[model samples]
Structures are given as C-alpha cells and as structure tokens.
Target: MSSTATTTEAAPTVELSTLPLRGGEKKAEEKAEEYKYAHLLPHFSEDRYPPLEPYKHIDPGHRALKHANPRAFLDSAERVVELTPHLGTDVKGINLANLDSDGRDQLALEVARRGLMVFRDQRDFIDRGPEFYKKWGQHFGRLHVHPTSGHPKGYPEIHLVYRDGNTSFNFEVDDSITTTVWHSDVSYELQPPGLTTFFLLASPPTGGDTLFTSQVSALKKLSPQFVAFLKTLKAIHSGVEQAEFSRAGRRGGIVRRDPVEHVHPVVRKHPVTGEEALYVNRQFTRRIVGLKREESEAILRLLYDHIDKSADNQARVKWEPNTIVLWDNRVTAHSANVDFRHLPDARHGARITPQAERPQPALEGLDLSA
Candidate 1:
C-alpha cells in the first residue's frame, strides 16, 4: 500500500463538556485502565462455521422447509431482538465539537460497543462522508476496496449510493432498499476494512432497512465445545466479484485487479479490542481452506445455521434522508434490505469511506508468525 503524510496547522483542540477525559497524557492513562481486562481473556473459540451433514435433503413435497418455527433453532429464546428507538425524527446532525465532553465520550463508547450507530439529517452526509469517517478510522487502518460492486468514481475513498427507482423485494415493503445477505464488507482483502460508514441522502418512499449482526454475540451463544473446534479452521474469500468490477476499469484506470482469493481463519481477534469474533459470512466466503469440497460445504452449512438463526444479536436500521451509519466491519456482519423493488421514486444517497485492518489470529497463544 502507498503511504502519504500531509501536515496541517493543528486546530485549537476544543474541550468538549461531556467526556470526563481530555486528549493528551491524562486520556491515555484513563483509557488504559478502562480496557486493561480486555487483553486478558482472549475470545478464541472453534468451528466458527459448521457443516450441513446433520441436515437431510428436503423432500420436494415438503414446502414447509422454507419456513420453520423461528424458535426451532434454539431450545431457549435468548436471541429475540426488539427494535429500539435511537435517533429521533430530527433532521439535523449533532456536531461533536458542540457536544458536552461526556457526550463525546458516550458516543465514542457507544460506537466501540455496538460496532454501529445511526445519525439523522446529517448536514454534511454527502459532502464530507470520507473526511468524517477518517476521524475515527485513521486510528485503525486505511480504507479498502469492495471485493465487488464498488462504485467507479469513488476509488478507495468512498462508494456511490444509489437505489433502483421503483423496485422492492416482494417479501417486504419499502423503497427498493434492503440488505439481504449477511456479510462483512470486503474480507477478501489482505488487510480488510475495519470500519464502514454509509451516509444516506435520499431513501425511497417505502423500504430500506439495514441489518447488523454481532459476531461476538454469535460466538458467545454457541456450545463451548463447538467453539473450540472452530479455532483451527480457515475459509477462503474470493475476489471474482471485485475482480469483475476491475475488469471494467471504471475509474481513471485506478481499479486494478487484486490477486487475493481464498480462505482465512474462521475466527479472528479484533486488533484493538482483543476480542475474538466469527469471521466468515455468506458473502465472499467460498470454502474451508484445507478441506475437500464436500467437507467444506457440509461444515459451512452448519456454521451458517448457527449464525443465521441467531436473530437476537442483530439490530436493524431504517434509513431516511440525510442519515449516516458507521459500523465496525471487523466484528460485525450487515445486510442491506433489498426490498424496495417496486417503488417508482425509490432512491438513496450515499458516500462510503473504506477502512483497513490486519486480521488477528484466533488463538491468542499463537504467535503472529504461526
């Protein structure tokens, strides 16, 4: 990767009122105390994705296989998710500078914990999407490319957001906007994006909701034995899709073909938080690294059920005009609801900034070279 540094006259650092800590030496000490324990218990668990052997071929006559009791996946109802109100109806962005110090800390803390948060009516959502995300993103890594379907003009900085007007998925109603498949953004990259920010400008009149699932929560709910099994596995994520986009050479010949494709550790640690999370997703992940094709399919099926059925660990966001969502792509999976298929005026506005981070090994005991 290319590196560049630009020096700017430092702006006067404003002391916000909400956070108890301020930048410089004191803040570092306080942060250390706050997260000291996270380094102690590494979240290495095994068999992050399982096989499909236990399940049988469904009889063609049994149409009911399409939908089953949501509770059938679990003996207990621990993962039921309820939509909670976060951002209000206001169409104004909250300026972090104007917020109290504690408020700044609270927002920072929330993004760290939730892996994502929403904002309403961001005044600069469209114009400053890349710059705004760089604020927190620079601390992690560089922006990365989407393995597939990244907008041509944006290059590595951001992705263009558009919705097919007058379209909605039949299963749901909304402006033709919905994230259907569960996935982390562009895991095929050697250093995947750590964070992703989506700024919405114009949403269709009806449906456009994004779903986010927690990798940490998914692992925590699994059997400890199965968790242990997943630690040794890795899966391949291919760039056929991203490569296809590069073939088009859409932007100033800047979208070069990437050579990376194949598997990675099924579970990886968060470089910053030191927490282990399930790293495989329905998107890009093609197979288990060293396993036979049949074996890989079976195992992947098992792992998918464990992830897909865990609905309680997910949050869904409905977008409106001038909304922006920022999420940690490392420890979370997201789906854009593609349900706004039928609306004539369905559209969305967006500017996406990429992020970059190296993958951490699943086992803390293993050295980096291992």
Candidate 2:
C-alpha cells in the first residue's frame, strides 16, 4: 500500500485507440477472456497458415535457422577475427552506432529472436551510472513509469538499488533458488511491455545468475494436441492476482488503473517477423476461455507445471558487474536467482526503461489447430 512518492505525473497512459491497426476501422472483437475452456484454433481458418503452435515449440524454427550465425555466413575474414566476449554477443558498450549497420541490425534481430542477450566485463558503461540509462534508453522507446510503486526516486527511467544502508528497494530474500518462479513484468496494464533493458551494477562474488526462457520456444515444444486446445482459449491477466498488498482498503482491493480489462490473442504474432508465438506466462496468465472454474484451474495447473518441468529449453546468464541484459518482453520470461546472498546486496547500477507495446488482434485467417 505504498504511494509512488514521486511528484511527477504518472507516465502517459497506454490507450488502445492510439495504436495504428492495418485498417482505421474499429470493431468489437469477441470477449472470450471469460470463457473457461475456449481455445484459439477451431475458431479461425486452418488453411491460411500452418499451425503456429509448432513454431512456438521448436528448438530451431525455419527462420531462426536461416540466420543462424550469419556472421559466419556473410562476414569476411576480419569480422570473424574478433574474439572479445563483449564484441561477440549483443552488448557492445553504449554506442551501437560504431558497429556496421548491417551487423548491428543482425545483432538486434538476434536479440529479438533469442529473447535475451548479454555483454560481459562492462566497466566503462556501468561506471557512468544512472544518467547513462537516459541516453541509450531514450533512443530505444518511451520510458515506462510504474503505475504504482514506480521507483523510489522521482526519475521514472530508473530503479536504483545499492548494498549499503537505507537507499531504496531492499531486494534481499533469504533463499537460494530464489527465482525458480517465472514472471513477466507489469502485465496488469492493457499495453504490456514490448521490451526491457536491465544492467547489473553490482554482482555477487559467487552464484547469482538470471534465467531466461523463450515463451515462444516453450509453446512450440507443446504437443500439437495441446497447442490446438490452447488456441481455442484466451486468459484473463491481472496484477490484482499478485500484488494483493497494493489493494489494501478497497471494495475488491483491486488497484486497477484502467477499470476496463484488456484482452490479447491467446497466441501472438511477432511484430517484426510475422511468425506467431504462444505468449502466456504463469505470473500474468490467469485462466482459460469457456471453461468452468475447476476446468480452467486444471488446464492452468498443467501448463504451469509443464513450463517448469521443461528445463532444457531455457538459458541462464551468470552475472558480472556492469553486465547489461536486454530482452524482448513479448517473447521471453525472466527470473532472478538468490544465490548471491553471501556476496552482498545486489544493487541496480541504473534504471529499467521498458518500451511501449502496440496491441494487435490476432489475424482472422490464422489457424491454431494443425
């Protein structure tokens, strides 16, 4: 039940009407979010496209494969010669302009496909501190303002944390497997985050690492039968389900900024690639369409269990101070591990600025069932 503390007006709201859909026409889509067992597949045409379910689950999709190591495929001998860890991955200091335009685009595309990308031994950039976040972040997109407990400081662009005394968020928890749970940031809003960038200002001496998993990859891994089943449904996602404390003394105790609920396609298409992905996450996805309470619970439980059970499908990044991690919020889910307790408090070196996402309705011709 804490207030935003900052005096600045809340970040600009995300309105559905502002987004540019293919046609200027406005139409009411089906309100299937309440249905318990309704899936997405049977409702749409099957022949227009292949079941996107398979694409969501696969290890290497046809598109990702085509561009696999394009550095190897298209680069000259000099491009292959760079062996520095920072140069190899997505993080190349703050100046992306220094990179070859095509190479930079390819790396950004790779980051989009991989969900998360990292840079190591990043000292120069991290030392510059909070102000540094503003420079590169503004170039990316509109910086997000937290609807509620935004940041301790007035600056909406950053969330500052340090190991010493009373500063801001005391991000300390007394458990080792701290982040075994999965979550997407701020799903309570209509326009969920499109992307996120978090850099590690300080890291533990030993084991604190972050795990990233591709929701699209996980969805593609599901059995065709299950994918078909899920396609027929939409789920309700609300912050009220989690942040109970935020709703202290209200009628429903729901601290909702927008009274109207936002509904998204059960399966999402990549904004850039046009390839589809199964986009639900445990923290945000609440229930299935058309099914009764018990039925929806059963389906959700199975899915919740399945995502955790499938471990090989994920990637983990061990933290090093000054390491910057950027990810596409639409396609990935992240969790923090608490093994760093012995080292000291893990302070955020800079702020987390997430981009605004455009809401898109699922195209009518697509099929969820193969």
Candidate 3:
C-alpha cells in the first residue's frame, strides 16, 4: 500500500462507551434524569440564528458550463461525464487508491463545481481497506464520527452501512420514519459534514441506486419572494429528536453518544463556490425557528416537496460493486433506494464524512425584500 493509503491490519476494537445504548438497557435512574433536564434545553437557540441579509444570486460560471455542453469542458487526462443538468458527474480513468496529491486536489475542485462525482471500477479501493478510505477523506478535511452509527474498527471515521434481507436493520421502518428520507449527512451537528464519499462493497443485481438532488437548484427554483424569506430563517436540526438509534436497537459499530441538536441557516452559502443552497433537509431539520408550528410545517412541506419531487434537480447513481461516489453534502441531499430489500445482502458500503464549519446564508447585498 502507498503511504497515502491507510490499512486496517492493526484495527483497534471500539470501546463499549462509544457505542449507542441498547433499548431497555438504560437504568430507571437514567430515564428519570433525562426527563428532569430535557426541558431546560430550548427547542432552538436564538444565538445560532442567521442574520437577515439582502438576496442576490451569485451565478458562478460552473452552472452555465453544466448547461452548455459539460462534456466539452473535460480535460484529456480524465473523462468527465455530466449526470444531470444541476448535479452529478462521472469521472473516468483515475484510480482513487493511487491518486497523488495533485490528482486528489484536482478531484476536489471537480466535486466543488459538480455537486456529486462518481468513480467506477474502484476494486482497488476495497482491497486497500478502511485506512485507504480514511486517508482519502483526510485530504479534504477532518473525518466525522457518526454519533449513532460508530466507525469501523481502527479507522474511527468510517461508517459501515450494511443490510441483509433477514435482519430488521433497514433504512426505513415505515413511512413515518423521517431519518430514512432525503437528507444531508449529519445536519444535526453544529459543524455539519461538507463532503461524503461512499464505496460500495456489495450491491444487488438491480436496485440500491442512490439519488442526489442539488440544493442550489432547489433554492433557484423557488419564487424570488420566498427565497428572500428563506434567507432570514434558521432551522433546528436534531439527532436525538429523530431517535433512529433508540428505535432501531443497538447494532454493532453503532456508537451510543448523547443526542445533539443545532440551529443552521435555512439557506447556506457554499464556502468554496460562493453559491447559495437550501440547507434544511427532511431527516434532521425539526422545524424552522421563530415561526408557529403550523406555519413552519406548511413552508417546510413546500420546500421538501420541491427538493424530493423535482426531476430537474436530481441525479441518480446505480451502485455496483467496486464503485465509489463522492458528494458535497453542503450543496446536495441524498436518499438510498431500498427497492432490493427482499434480496439478501442487498447493499453494503462504507462512508466517510468530512467536517465543516457552521452554515451561513448566501445572501448578496441586493435588497430583494422590497
């Protein structure tokens, strides 16, 4: 293995405290304590609210290039195929496991321009183990440690996602489970993940395709008046409120940390591209701050419907073994297609989320409120 890649040969065992607490295992005292202090934590914090700013669209030329023959922009060294009008690109002829510093830097720039990028035939990645994945993730930023789904053995940043037909550990339990719906990865954290990369180890014959939609497109499609309103809003995102870990029971590699919640801008500006994108997601965003519950729900429902139902904003990736997908979580929302649930070992993959700073609205000084 190259120095840039990390191996799992000396993988360490995850500590028991790091795993999520199993159902019915919490003592009565712990339950009593939780009830006592739960009310003290405000539903949302005002300090985290985003400042209202004038609405202005900064059209980075990347979107224009995407519309005007995206393939024509590809360099000779790599074949870049655009997957959708707004998001997703397929990059061919680069081996992820062996990428030098310069190649990795170029790949990052492409992902910034295109919300999501896919690299097919990454069999060498699987052979390199969890360390290889971790190292690649490190190039962008610090790796995120999932609060519920614990990291793989030695590499504390890799989230191991797996499903088998016989087990109850599926993505969605019922239609009511919001966590299984479309969402940006770990939006509940104060510093949500900026980028995520997933490598498929096993994929069923058909199905298990992941869909990604651009938040940039989602924001642009809304009425200008509504976009102005969204700039002044903040939403509460919570991991404990969603309660996926408690409902699903204790599973291996699932860390049992205390639930965390944070307030984030409803519309965020991408740090690198300076593009504005809708930050609220169905899975983690509990409610919009400073609004009546009814009003918030109506507005959120409209935004959610726009994001999930819009075909023009989406790009779909059909997973195959040895395939790798990288997406900018800051600008994209994704959902896994569970159509192959009936098949044993339907889908399996490892993911790494790179840490990012708090989100800020991308409002330019145009005074659109008038």
Among these predictions, the greatest TM-score belongs to: 3
**Model 3 superposed RMSD (Cα):** 11.0
Task: Give the per-residue lDDT digits (tens) of candidate 1, residues 1-370.
Answer: 0001111111111122211112222432343243321111111111112211121211111222233431132222223233432211111336432333334334433444457766554554344444554453333344443332323222334444333332211112233343366778767666666545565434445565677778888877878888787787777786665455434432111223444664567888765456678888876788876678999899888877777777777776766545566667777887766555454432433334444445666865533221
Q: How many residue pairs clash in each candidate?
A: 58, 22, 5
Q: List TM-score per model, in order.
A: 0.63, 0.63, 0.75
Q: lDDT winner among the candidates? A: 3
Query: lDDT by residue for model 2 over 1-370, one digit each (tens)?
Result: 0001111111111122211122211220232223221111011111112211111111112233356574432243222222222112344434332334344445445556666666544555545544655665554455555432323222545643323121223223335434466666665455666546666433334565667666676777888887776666666666654444434421112232422234555666666555556656676677665679999898778777766776755766656545666676667776656544343322333446545454343355433221
Q: In model 1, how large is the Cα lDDT of residue 81? A: 32
lDDT of each: 0.49, 0.47, 0.63
In model 3, where do residues sit more than 4 Å from their true spots?
1-78, 168-171, 175-180, 242-244, 247-255, 364-370
What's model 1's TM-score? 0.63
Give the better candidate number (1 or 2) by TM-score.
2
* lDDT over C-alpha atoms for residue 63 of model 1: 24
Poorest 10 consecutive residues of model 3 by lDDT? 37-46
lDDT of 3 at 250: 37
